[model samples]
Target: MSEDTETVSVHGREFQRTSLDEGVYYAPVAFDDREESRLTAQHEIVSRIFGDGLFSPRIPVGEPEAILECGYGGGDWAVQCADEFEDCEGMRVRRLSSRPMSRQMDRPENLDLVAHNLNDPLRDPEIFKANHYDLIHSRFVFPGIKSGRWNGYIRDMRLLLRPGGWVQIMEYLPIIQSHNGRLTDQNAVRRWWQEYQGAMADMDRDPRIGRRLKRLLLDNRYRDVEVDIVQLHIGDWSKNETQASIGRDSVEMIGDLLESLGLWPFTSKLGWTAARFEDLMQEVRAELQNVELNLYIEL
Candidate 1:
């Protein structure tokens, strides 16, 4: 890892420059493979963008021979890309609080995991020089940005990307799922979405960050960029067995994120009392118990 990294603190969570591994993000006590599957799903979206040819898009002379990923929340995508595009360098950002680099670099591979607080503007705001990088990728980065320093997200990407270099921002549209393709209470779901959308608008994080990416690329001076709203169905919710299991697990994941950052102290206006929230969550879980599968975004 590079020694020239910076650190910052916001919303009580500290950000540091460090590399990542499975054990850092995933709890050592958890036995499930959900995180593993989530990483696979993200790569599938990238694969769809790459089409059937070699990983590298035809590039003009003097372009950097590497790709950069802004917030490598999970390192799996970089690992997969390294396996696929052996010649391209895959870049990733690491939290400052993570484990030592010596342990992570023990495995010899082409991928370079760096230690850098990605949102620090003064520290080479533009990661790669102008016209550098064949492609730049970032995903699931907004939740972290809510703490502060939002502009750094766009500015860094714009400054780092080489002219004509492709930049792809794949983000999830925040949505609370319902089993059986029917909202448990249409009013409740609608209310949740309206308020959620309004919050995102205020934060400048587009709800359709995935679909709006084309416009973002254009606005940021990227040429020939395209965005797709890819909706993935995890399971067939109509089948009772599947939906119930997913519903239970999905609610648990949201609870985990909320509690992880100590965020529950701020959401009282939503009418979510401890008991009421559990009841509602259990309702969704029960709804899933009767259904076979479910669909949701990663946000």
Candidate 2:
């Protein structure tokens, strides 16, 4: 393994990392590959969400010389792109708190990983060169950044991309909507989302940022901006194996993340004790187990 590949320990977890800002933000997810099955499943879900091809009309099919994936969790998307576009160089950036980089031993030589936080603008002299990239992308990065920073982040993306270059951002809408108007206030998952929004509100992060990306991009003067919203079933409710698998993966993943994504923020910002949070989660888990619940999320 290369020297940089060595894992570092933080709070009993082992992952490679770069220096971080003193008190920037907290990340609830762990970076261990053992906990990353959901991330792989997420990429598949996203591909299905857009019917494949990375969801940007401005980006062409042929290889581009440069690509950047901000918040490049697990590097799956970057590696896949590297393999498809053999001559293209791909750079991925992530914060230290996102856990570890992907562990693909046979990764392409053209793919590079860097530890850089997206909450701030690109500052490295070489990376900051104006109009230096052919494409830029990010997925599920809202939780780790302050709500107000997205405008600045999009502005940075605009500066990094060359003329006619593409920029894509994918985020889970985080709201539970039902097709038949069955998702009532009494539903546990619906209640869970309510609590989540409340906690995020207290923390000043916006869980609804998914719906605002189009306006943010256009406000930054990005031309030809397009937003694709994909609706996915919450669990095995969809009967189709692929959709069920995607839903199952999502439920399982979020189940694993409940503590980080749910408990911590709620406890810190809303003043709920762990015991009290668990009580609420018990009700929420019961709702998750109902196949007939039929909840769907927009991506």
Candidate 3:
């Protein structure tokens, strides 16, 4: 409700404007309580992927002076890190590679939220002092990062980290795999990804960069880099209760996100009419409900 904030509704889904991205045409996700609620659920789903903890084992154990979270949406993970390490400094950047959500959480005194674009140069000593951070984490941001800039991003993370500082990222492969080989051109999942990836390709972003993170990190001179892949079931088809719950949520989340993920990319870049997009979405939704499909996403 700030004077600077404006709400924009597209196809009934609302987005708030805190500030325009580096590209004037692109705006981050809305900064509303409802958006925060969605981000909270997303954080839960992500936490389950890392064994229900905010800090991953791949990250170093002991607390350091400063920590940075790239693409911190809703500020949930940053706030949790601040609470756990009250004495440590927690810094979060908005709109790096995720939807921009609210930064108005009741965070601890140690946590600082700032609006920053990660695509910019990090080697600039004035902006990011070299070798300053102890730990850095980014999740699910590969979609927003341009393909050519991945190396620059890795270099920035490496330069910003202090000696032996750890960096961890979690991203998912865009392609959906089905055990039954049901993800054909006739199926919704494959069709959706085809359109989705095509649109991202138009924007020069690679949606399937999850499997290459380890190589990128090692090539960038990051020591002890680790990649952990978690597969999410498409529906409530898992024997384990926790994973089943995550799967159920995942299905709902995908249903909810179909528009946000595809609207602009498919319409503006790929020439998808609204009606055609809606029909495609419906097809994808139908496939999501098929328990026999056994579709999975690798993260």
C-alpha root-mean-square deviation, each candidate: 7.9, 3.9, 3.0
| Candidate with more favorable, higher lDDT: 1 or 2 | 2
TM-score of each: 0.57, 0.81, 0.87
List runs of model 3 lying over 4 Å from the truth. Answer: 1-7, 15-35, 89-99, 124-127
Ranked candidates, highest TM-score first? 3, 2, 1
**Candidate 1 overall Cα lDDT vs. reference?**
0.44
Q: Which candidate is the best by lDDT?
A: 3
| 157-245: candidate 2 lDDT, tens digit per residue | 89988787788788877776776677788776777788888888777678899988999999989888777687777777786887887
What is the TM-score (0 to 1) of candidate 2? 0.81
Over 4 Å off, model 2:
1-25, 52-59, 89-99, 103-107, 236-245, 257-260
Q: Candidate 1 at 219: error in angstroms? A: 1.8
Candidate 3's residue-wise lDDT over 55-102, tens digit each? 686665586787878877677887787778776544433224334546
lDDT string, candidate 1, 52-105, tens digits: 321324333233366776655446555565555665444332222132222232
Global lDDT scores for all candidate models: 0.44, 0.66, 0.70
Residue 273 of model 1, lDDT score: 57
lDDT against true structure, model 3: 0.70
Model 3, residue pairs in steric clash: 16-30
